[model samples]
Target: MAVRQVIFAALGVSVLALGACSGDGDPILMHAGAQNRGPDEFAILPTKPLELPDDLAALPAPNPGGANRVDPQPRADVARALGGNPAAAVSPGAMDGGIVNYASRFGRNADIRAQLAAEDLAHRQRNRGRLLERVFAVNVYHSAYEHMWLDKYSELERWRRAGARTPSAPPRELLDN
Candidate 1:
């Protein structure tokens, strides 16, 4: 009886040792869902080969038929309205009289020009103040009022000083466009 029990214990110990050793040497069986079924399901499709042209440098020049075409009649009408002759309007270096040429005409001591600039500045300030008031009125928050106030007065003062240093002049080449 004792010998049979010893043999049974030895057999059980050897079986457990063999299972541990087998587990250590065996590769893990990965459950990759449907990917591990077979190569027939996961095989890549063959790509079609591309054929190149024999003469690569024989391309034809671009056609200009689709380019925009301009009509001279409307341009001539516009030039006529701007004080140029409609028939002889196609000449180069023609004076259309569309430009005022203030820099050439008005000296630095021109009272009318200075008065016009001051009036324009006053108009701009009134419009800007009204706009700022409307914007702040839309929002009931007091912080918006403070921000608008600073923007209108302080920023406008800075811009006015900058403008005084470099007084605004009309753009050159007014008739070209």
Candidate 2:
């Protein structure tokens, strides 16, 4: 009876250990986004929204590590206007709205994540995940691996200078090959 009980206990512990390692992600490829969240450095934080670029070809060259052209950062300007610190305004603070209630002044981005996830499902359907990504549930790591780190603004300038239908570069994998 004592031997039988010890066997059962050992089996249970082994099962638990295996269960811990058998998660959705591959341990070798899953370390991105694990650091402390910080302010986006490459983002262009204009004090106000950009007007339509009359001469589309004359804008500054976009960085590979930058945000898109149209992300609206209206709060920084608003906070400066209202005599509040722009840094304090920009940093997330639910209860620290200096001039007006945050809820009253701004629409909460609480549901924005869920909305983006829903759109991402549609995007995945269109783009189609690779076999390894689908099998190992490596969406995050796969995105990091597959990202095209190009300077869109510089690419636009290159195209403008060519003054012809310049052929686009092939995907990174082709270059690797």
Best by TM-score: 2
lDDT of each: 0.51, 0.63
Error of 2 at 92 (Å): 5.1
For each candidate in turn, the TM-score is 0.18, 0.24
* Candidate 2 segments exceeding 4 Å error: 1-110, 130-177
Q: Write the per-residue lDDT of candidate 2 for residues 1-177, one digit (tens) a residue.
A: 999999999999898667655665434434554433454577755544567988888988878878554655467668878999866765556546664464557656668899998986776576556775555454454454356568665676577577756358554355446
User: Model 1, residue 127: what's the lDDT?
Assistant: 49
Tens digit per residue, CA lDDT, model 1, 1-177: 999999999999898667554422212222111233335644554433554658879755666774222333555666779998777755443463334455446545558788988976675455454454454332222332344455544454566567654235323243224
Residue pairs clashing in model 2 are none
Separate clash counts for every candidate: 0, 0
lDDT of 1 at 151: 50
